[model samples]
Target: MTTPLPIGSTIGILGGGQLGRMLSVAASRLGFRTVIFEPGADCPASHVAQAHIQASYEDAAALRRFAERVDVITYEFENIPTSALDILEALRPIHPNREALRISQDRLTEKTFLSNLGLTTAPFADIPDAAALDGALQTIGTPSILKTRRFGYDGKGQARLSSPREAAQAFSDMNGAPAILEGFVDFSLEVSIIAARSQDGQVSAYDPGENVHEGGILRTTTVPAKIPARLQTDAVLLAAKILNALEYVGVMGVELFVTPTALIVNEIAPRVHNSGHWTQNGCTVDQFEQHIRAVAGWPLGNGERHSDVTMANLIGDDMDRVPALAQDGACALHLYGKAEVKPGRKMGHVNRVTD
Candidate 1:
C-alpha cells in the first residue's frame, strides 16, 4: 500500500477548470494544499488553488518543477498529453494511473476495454478512413453517430447520420481524424454511478443520478434516479466491477444507458463528473472530497445520501436566471468565477435540496 501523505503536503492537479477549482476546495478542507498546472491564464481553478503553473502540457521544464513540489499528482480531466505524463510520472505518483488515462482518452479503446472485461457497451465500429466508415455503416446501419476517437466532450467532435445519404457529410465532419460509429441505443434514461476506490482496493459508489442533457451538454442531474431497485443494484455492482478491473485509485464516473432490457455502458470519465454535482448537497462526503480522500491514501467515505437533490448547470444564457436562483432559500449556488460566458460554456450550477 502507498503511504498516505501528511496533511500539509501539496497535491498537483493537471487542467485548471471548474472541476479542478472544486477539487482544490476539497483538498483545502482536508488540510492539504493544491497547485494547478494549466495553459490558460486566469483559469477558474487558478482562483482557488494555492499556486498556479501557467504552462502548456508539453512544457517539460514547467512539468518538472510541478512534479518536484507535489507529493502526489492527480488530474481534473483525461485529455492530458502523453509527453507531459512521461515527465510527471517519473517524479511523483499519479492517481488512477496512466493505464486508466490511456483507456478513457479514446472512445474506441474505452469500448474495447469494456467489452474485453465482459461488460456491455453500445455496438460500435472504428472508422480509420472513409472506406472504414462505409464498412462500419454497412454493418452498424443508419441512425448512428460518428464521433472522433479522441478529445470529444459536451457534444463536440461528433456528427449524426440519420441515413446512408448523410454519410459523406458526417465523414467530412471528422476533419481527417480517426472516428468511431456507434449504433443508436433506445435507452429510457441516462444514469451515472460516481464510484471511488482506495489504494488498498476498497470501492464505494454513490447512488446513481439520472441525467438530462441539452444540446449535448449536461443540464441537470437528479439523485435517486427513477430506476428500479434491481437496476440500481446492478448499476452499483457494475461500477464496482469496473473499478476493480482497472485497479483504480480515486473517483470515476461511469455513464450508463438504461434500456428496457439491459444497462449499456455509454462512457466512463476517469475523474469526478458533472452528473455527480448533486452529491455536494445530498451526501455527507461529496464526490470531490471522496476523490481527495482516495488520492490522498485516506479511507473511502460511506457515500450515503441523506437528501434528494436536483443539480442544474447554468449554461451561457442560463446565467441570467442566477439572480432568481440565488434568492431561493432551498438552493445552493456554486459559481465557477469565470469572467466570460460564451454560449455552451458552463458558468456555474445550483443544487436544490429537499429532505
Candidate 2:
C-alpha cells in the first residue's frame, strides 16, 4: 500500500453516491481508473466510474470480484457495514483506515475520541436504553440533542430536548437503537476544515469555511469564514491533530462550533465534504482530486485558496433554478445526474467564485 498506484490502476469505491461519482472523476484526472461497488442500481457514481459492480455488500462473491479488480479501496460514506468491510479489508488496502471509520460511525464514539484527543467537544453521554436516557438527561440536562448512535444524518434519527419530559418521546423515536445525549453548544457560527493526510504522513488543510444549514442539511459554505485569524489557525491545527492521530490517508471534514471562547468539535466526516466543494472553483487541486491523490498513495496536492467562494447545495427543488444559474457567469454548476429527486436530497451543487 506504500507504493503509489500506477496510471490506469483501478480504485474500488464502496459507495456509488454523488461523492463517489465526483471521486471517480477526480481519479480519472490523475490517470487512474475507478470501480464503484454499490447495492443500488443506476447510482450516480456508476455514470462516471470506469466500472460498476451492482451487488449487495453482504454478497461475498460480488465483494470478492470487486476487490480483485482494484488496487486499493476507499469509501464515500462511513456507515458501511462491518461485515462488508471485513471482507474487503482482507483483500485490498482501505485508506483513511478502519479505525477512523469505526470512530466516526457512532456519535458517542466520535465525541469520546475527540475529547480524548484533548480537543474541545460538547458535553456528551451514552444512552443505551430508556433508563440510560433518563440518567443522561439528568447528567447532560435539557436544551440538548438526543441522537442515535449510528445511521443518522441530515438531522434525522435525532431529537432536540428543551426539557427532560420530552426524553420519553425522543427515546421512543430511536426505536430501541443506541443513542447519545449532547449538551447544546452555545456558538456564534459553524465552520468546517477540510483536511488531507498523505500516505507518507504529510498533512494539508484548506481554509475554514463558514457553514449555514437549513432543515439539518448544509445550505451553503462560504470560505474565508468570519472568524478571527487565531481561531482559523486553531481550526486547522486541530484537524491536523485528528488526522495524524488516526494515521489517516485521504481527506476528512472536521465540523466545529465557533464559540466566544474555544472552537468546539461538532463532528468529523472522514471523506471529501460538502463544504469543501467551494474548492472546485477556488483552488487548483480541489478536495476531490486531493483525496484521489492521497488514497492512491501519491503526494498530496496544494489546497491553498486563490479566491473567496461560496458553495451552495442544490437540494430537491433547487434543480429548477439550473437554467438561470447556468446563465450566470460567475458560478460553476456541478450536477449529480440523479434520476429522481426527493425532498432534502442533494441533487447537485454550485460554486460561486469571486476575487
RMSD for all candidates, in order, please: 0.9, 1.0
Off by over 4 Å in 1: none
In order, candidate lDDTs are 0.94, 0.94
| Candidate 1, 1-355: lDDT as tens digits | 7688799999999989999999999999999999999999999999998999999987899999999889999999999999999999999999989989999999999999999988899989999999888899999998999999999777888999999888888999989899999999999999999999999898999999999998898999998899999999999999999899999999999999999988999999999999999998998999999999999999998799999999999999999999999899889999999999999999999999966
Candidate 1 RMSD to the real structure: 0.9
Candidate 2: where are CA atoms >4 Å away? Answer: none
lDDT tens string, model 2, 114-161?
999999999999998899889888888989999999998888898999
Give candidate 1's whole-model lDDT: 0.94
What does the lDDT read for residue 271 in candidate 2?
96
| Clash pairs for candidate 2 | none
lDDT at position 29, candidate 1: 90
Give per-model TM-scores: 0.98, 0.98
